[model samples]
Target: MNDRPYHHGDLRRAVLTAALDVIAADGPSGLSLRDLARRAGVSHAAPAHHFKDRTGLLTAIAAEGFGLLAATVNEATDLKDAGVRYVRFAREHPAHFQVMFAPGLLRTDDLELTTARALATDALRTAVAEVRPAEQGDDARLAGVAAWSLAHGFATLLQSHNLDGAVGGRDPEEVFRTLSGLLFRQG
Candidate 1:
């Protein structure tokens, strides 16, 4: 056996990127650290250097997903637009979305995961702040929940092919515009 030390430079990122690709193609259930290391062209134990175990790798993936979602949501021009962006991100990053909300798979206490989740939540809170009317207290919170629910439901429906026949011929952006407009109609 070759005696060269298997020091994979930037192994953490390499493993994570490889893991994302694997999750995208085969779902989270199919992920394996040894497989990830192989894909990264590193030794089987290389991934473990960065991620202690499979759970650590999964937590990192969830963290990355939330970070991307936060950035996308924060870039929206308006609160209503941010809701649309949320749905767009989910549709565009189905693998990430699939991993982000998969309970019992990620370590909830992991610092990276917690930080990323906070950033995403903060982005949503900012969006809510923009649209909340004065004198609306609990109602504002409810509105935020409604916005999230609508976006998540729409994304899930799109992913599951439930809307394929229903949304035929209509541009996705146009559909989002109409749906967001209806949801955010001024009362």
Candidate 2:
């Protein structure tokens, strides 16, 4: 049990941290608000006070993940950089990544979730546009979708250890770069 003191919004942070830990270890299906409250060293009802229920908690995680993804990819210098950033975000935040895309587990209409998703989408679109100045409209949109699919598919495979033997000790990010280069041969 945590012996740390709780102040103001500390409980919310604690609960969120605990939830992430649980999700990291056991995936989203294993998350329980009661278990989170116990892990956070607070009353069982404490988490409910902040998140209302399991879906609400997952919604919060999804929103936070999208926001983090947007910020991460927004730092990219090019399309490959953006794809690398997306893969890195998934690798670094597997729990969040797993939860963020599971539409069935989230509050689809949640304002924060919708807003964060938009931010990530816009960032990816901007990255695609910046990379292909002549390719606008549907071409740019398709490029963004293709880039996203490649990065997302690679990240998911990497996370599941499907690339362990195939990568042959190469850094996953580097492997992603190689793969992205093959798929998106610029000029």
Candidate 3:
């Protein structure tokens, strides 16, 4: 007999939000469906109904992360803006960052994940092109790689606390702007 309160008005969303909170504090490894249920005040089996398994829950999280990234980048004013926003997103959603990029943590082949990732990729590539405008595919592709690597690396380092002193206490966005400008040799 499932004796939990099961008071969630929208169990799926409540569970997902609770999962994000859990992930933020404990990382993905610390998450459990039962714990999520408890946090959501739902029956333990309620989460299972929404997510067949842990992988299913993680897959949904990853998909949402990519969509969030896409929206964040697409709203930026320029390549530098996009880079700054990427870092900001990472900082704001550390749990999503942790689960989204870690391939082994989620079902990468899930259709929802693939579609969301494609959208994020397209948005990122467009921003990268703005970094170094070019007509040739190779140049643009390489520039995109460079831009993505810069932002991803910066964000990853910051998220992991490896860059506490790398930027000398300046805001992360400023540090990224400076590094990106120097790397791309842009004004």
lDDT agreement of model 1 with the native: 0.83
Tens digits of lDDT, candidate 2, 58-164: 99999999999999999998888999999999999999999999999999999999999999998898888866653467787788789899999999999988989
- For each candidate, the alpha-carbon lDDT, in order, equals 0.83, 0.89, 0.88
What is candidate 3's local distance difference test score? 0.88
1-187 in candidate 1: lDDT tens per residue?
Answer: 2244677778898888888878878889899988887778777887788889999999888999999999999998787788778888887888889889986998999999999999998898778777785358898888888888888888888877789898887766568768888878644
Runs of candidate 2 exceeding 4 Å displacement: 1-9, 133-135
What lDDT score goes with residue 73 in model 1? 94
TM-score of each: 0.90, 0.92, 0.93
Greater lDDT among 1 and 2 belongs to 2
- Which candidate should be chosen as best, given TM-score against the real structure? 3
Which of candidates 1 and 2 is the stronger one according to TM-score? 2
Residues 1-187, model 3: lDDT tens digits: 6675656679989889989998998899998998888778777788998888888998999999999999999999888889999999999999999999989988899999999999999999888766666686798889888888999999999988999977776898998898888877543
